[model samples]
Target: MDVFEVVADDVRRDLLLALRRGALTAGELARTRSDVSRPAVSRHLRVLREAGVVQSVVDGRRRVYSLRPDALAPLATFLAALTPPAPPVPARALDGLDLEVRRTTRERRTAHGAAQQEESA
Candidate 1:
């Protein structure tokens, strides 16, 4: 479907990793694993190509599949945006400081009022 969905598949992810080393022909890719048939590998490559995660070009008579580095741009951007900024002082921490200041101000005001009442008496 998309780049993330395409790479979410184990087969497709493996294919991309393999291509990272160098471009590999479909047959070569199939031969690398015993469980996967050549046709299956080809199908996975087709999906990757559609997602733009992989690209293929004719080399001699064979089509070699390679990773498209640009295709990973979306993922990189998404991850970068998600990274949290450096932690600054928290609101709760500031709230304690504010409370202390308010308490001291109230005490000062009450003490001043009491002194005035004493002087009047």
Candidate 2:
């Protein structure tokens, strides 16, 4: 499984989040979540390990798991490539836009004779 597939599981994602703080034993990880059984957590850990999302090593009789952030580089790079660059910002604000609108309206009213009617009233 790729890192993305391994991380698709809710249980696996939670395990990754927990490991982000630091490495933890399988037992410690299992204890953090009551919804998943220890065996299930172990299975998720194995998947993560195989996908290179996490690494494990023996600490005497037990194993400790830690995140491998480099495993996500491909996904990050792919995303960055897909994202379009931001549109260029305008050089200046349209400060005279309201004034231009008022001038246009006045010219249109004068052409239609409304300006003369308003002035005589």
Candidate 3:
């Protein structure tokens, strides 16, 4: 399967995310979530390995897997291209709002000061 097809599966995606932290054995990957069985995880891992999304190494009797981040460069670049640039906010757009806030603050302070003076008198 291709990278896109391999990643389309939720279990395979989860396995990739778990492997992102570091290399993990099949058992370790299986333990990442409780919903999937060990055999299911192994199947997902096999698909990922076949797709070049993950690399595996023999560590004694265990096979450890790690994410091949570079393999995802095409997908990342494609997604980045698809994202539209953010629209720029016009300058002074909030000037009226700012002025109203300042006016409200001044009015409140003046009213408070007048009340205090009246109480003292």
Error of 1 at 114 (Å): 74
lDDT of 1 at 106: 100
Give the clashing pairs for model 3. Answer: none
Quick one: best lDDT, which candidate?
A: 3
Ranking by TM-score: 3, 2, 1
Give candidate 1's whole-model lDDT.
0.87
What value of lDDT does candidate 3 attain over all alpha carbons? 0.91
Off by over 4 Å in 1: 83-121
Report the Cα lDDT for residue 39, model 1.
Answer: 88
Residue lDDT tens for model 2, 1-121? 8876876789998998999999999999998889999999999899999899899999999999999989989877888999999987564555477678899999997777976787889
Candidate with the larger lDDT of 2 and 3: 3
- TM-score quality measure for candidate 1: 0.63
Q: Model 1, 1-121: lDDT tens per residue?
A: 9877887888877787888899999888777765888889889889988888888999999999888989989887888899998889889889989999999999999999999999999
Q: Alpha-carbon error at 55 in model 1, in Å?
A: 1.2
Off by over 4 Å in 3: 88-121
Candidate 3, residues 1-121, lDDT tens digits: the string is 6787887888888898998899999999999878999998998889898889999999999999999999988889889999999988676888888899999999999999999999999
